[model samples]
Target: MVRVLAFLFLVTAALALDPLPPERIQALAAYSNAHGGHALLIRQNGKTLHESYSNGHTQNEPHRIYSGTKAFWCLTAFAAEKDGLFKLDDHVADTITEWQSDQRRSKITIRQLLDFTSGLEPLFGLHQNDFKDRAAAALKAPLVGTTGKSFIYGPASLQVYHELLKRKLREKEQTPIRYLERKVLGPLDLGPQRYLPDPKGTPLLAAGFMQTALQWSELGSWLLKHEEIVSAFKPGNVNRAFGFGIWNNHAAESKSAREVDVEDTLDKKWHAQSWGNACLCRSAPADLIACLGSYGQRLYIVPSQKLVIVRLAKDSKPNDAQMLRLLFANTR
Candidate 1:
């Protein structure tokens, strides 16, 4: 009996220690504070390891996740595919119809749109507060390049996808947001969560999702359990480091992996020569996938480590590689 009790005591003691050491946590806190981080939450092996909120922020408040919103739609697309809505390889022109006349535009595939290789012009104006009929605006935007060539990261491509998805659901008389809520968020219990909509009542798939750190972590957990859906995180050919709506670290050692600063990409320079071609963290596990947004909102899932981390900030600079290095310093 004594021996059994001793074993249990040791296990409890081990569990009591923070996964990250005190000094490391201090360093992270200082780094976060210096960079406008409001909340940071980490979970490992299905247990809460650490949670911190600052600058008058609390765990209950929902903060805008910005482009982190894209991952949800990406996962929803997987669900939509399973439900026979459309295939990833389906050409956008087949459904958009308007694109059929333009040879380059007709070549755009559903996969290419989410992968940011659709060659559509990256229009930031679709995200403006007063912009009405964002989907119409996106559909009307001309293709600036050839499909399957370059990674053009912006709201226009996703908004165009919104229109495509809208057309797909037209027969069923269901909206994209309603389909997403029913197919994805409802199963995950992530709604009653807020999604900002445009004047045409289309959910802004490119940005404007608000959820608390814990709520976002739930999404990471859900992704970890759904392997088929997680396959969307695989590195794409055009940009070796990006997948559907997330950044991948799987190709950190690949010769084709191009390094671009995450902070610089958010400055609305969607047409820049260098974008959408970098690992989130070189030192993190190769299976690490991240949903990053403007202003440092991050949802990181490390399946190999059985870990999920959510960080919410106002407009902090990205130091993902450094932060992951600290997080994994002692872990094997």
Candidate 2:
């Protein structure tokens, strides 16, 4: 792909793209103050930057990345793949004994789990149950759609996959948390973190992950460089096809969110891909910039523009369209 020098040059060049002026910084500050607080425009190399803000918190503070945990789990999957613990085609039922008796589940593979096509029926209305019970009930649940056919964007399939993987690894005397600590977090020098395990004492692989924006940025930057993370997945021949579990964020037009409200125009333009589990991530403006500097949320290596863009907000009301348009136009 793109050479490392080319990527670095692009990042350096992009930082010069209209550095947030005093007025804009003030506006962002005001915005952050109004909504708890925020950080802004913290730049690293083209591969990393930091934009963080909080109402009462400041930089280096911990926040619930919500479903951003999905991306983190994706990283774990990469680690697993790189270690050759399991192949993408490995059968989920084979990995988890409970599912083997169920013929439908026997057909499910790790690839299907990553693509949200496992067809596992969802276990709803168990917010009261601890993580373990919730996961157990989900495993016993029935299948709805045929495996690898319907794209049911829900939690049931992933939850089951997490439990299965956790069990499989645990049998080998491994756990997701340990795997992440030794393989991912530790490798990146990111530690002093926590991940809640299910009642059965397994890392909630599909969810229950927490980290600061800085930690998130570290993972994001790694992806932007096409470093070890993406190397785990053999890239698919299809441009936007899901390879392993990670979505390739190569272009703005390849996402599904672009058509969120504009159904009539869905075919006219592709939408932004959804980073499931975690929705749009939350961080200060600066942390987000670092992520964008390396194409954090987009998960692509765009050395030509040397630009990464990230927006973190509880709601999309403040309007990112105008700001992103301006940013892209100036950079181009």
Candidate 3:
């Protein structure tokens, strides 16, 4: 009986997840504040471990997440697949019949578009709220690289995806945004957003979302429970660090892995960008994955630790590798 009790105690202790020490948490907050961060929220082991606000910001104010919006929209694709709408491997040209004539565009799959490997031009103009009829512009965007071989991160592929999803959901008399609200947002308890739609009513899929730290953390927390979204973490052929609107640190395990400043590199022209074996932070756990947006907005998840962190800011971006290194520093 004594031996059995000892074994049970060991198992329980091993399963328990302790909170990070106060000093480490304080350091992380200080790091965030130094980089213009307005809000910081952290959750671990199914509990709220830390929460703070700076820059005269309050918890009630929503901050623009910019590209972090992609992560939420990408969830709609997985949810659609679950609803028997369409598979990720399905060709986008199947729904956007206008592209059937283009040899390169016709062969592009939904996965390729979501993974930013569809070879579409990075049509950043669509990000502007006044750029009316974004879907039309995306359909006419030319292929600038080899399909499935280039990682062109921009609004064009996502706009194409929006058009495709819009057509597929038409039979049910549903819009893609509504489908997303019903399938993804509703479940996470995230209500309506600004969406930053063009005059023709197409939301900017690449950027434009305003969310508070607590609100964005909800997505990261929900991510841990849904096994179906595993596809979101799988890397594409060209960009090993990114897939389905989120970036992963899995490459940190490799000896040759290089920590790249994601925002700065993404700003480079596609031909100039080099994304091979990129790591967010070499010192952080390999399981660390993040939803990053312009101006230092970040929602980071370390599944192995049951951890979720949200940082919101504007006009200034922090170093991802440095912030993540601070988060996990000295924590084994």
Best lDDT among the predictions, by candidate number = 3
Q: Number of the top candidate by TM-score?
A: 3
lDDT of 3 at 189: 96
State how far residue 41 of model 1 sits from its true place (Å): 0.6
lDDT of 3 by residue, 1-332 (tens): 99999999966854786667778789989988877989999898667889999979999899989889999899898889989999999999888888899878889999999999999898888888899799999999989988999999999999999999999989999998898889888998988887888888889888877888888998998997774575456789999999999999988888998999998998799999999889999888888899998889989998777889999986465799888878775564
Error of 1 at 313 (Å): 1.1
Stretches > 4 Å off in candidate 2: 1-37, 41-54, 124-132, 231-258, 261-312, 316-323, 330-332
Tens-place lDDT per residue, model 2, 4-108, is 889998767766655434454455445534543333333334433446565554566555544445555556666677777787779987778777887788888
Candidates sorted by TM-score, best first? 3, 1, 2
Residue by residue across 1-332, what tens digits does model 1's lDDT show? 99999999967865664455667767776778678989998887678877999988998999999888888888767877889989989999999998899877888889998998888788878778678888888888877867788778888888888888888998999988888889878877877555667776776778888899999999888887776777766545777777788887875555665445676755645556554447665556778888888888989887765678899998556777777777655453
What local distance difference test score does each model get?
0.79, 0.49, 0.87
Off by over 4 Å in 1: 1-23, 254-259, 266-268, 275-277, 329-332
Which candidate, 1 or 3, has the higher lDDT?
A: 3
Which ten residues in a row are the worst by lDDT in model 2? 286-295
> TM-score for every candidate vs. truth?
0.88, 0.67, 0.94
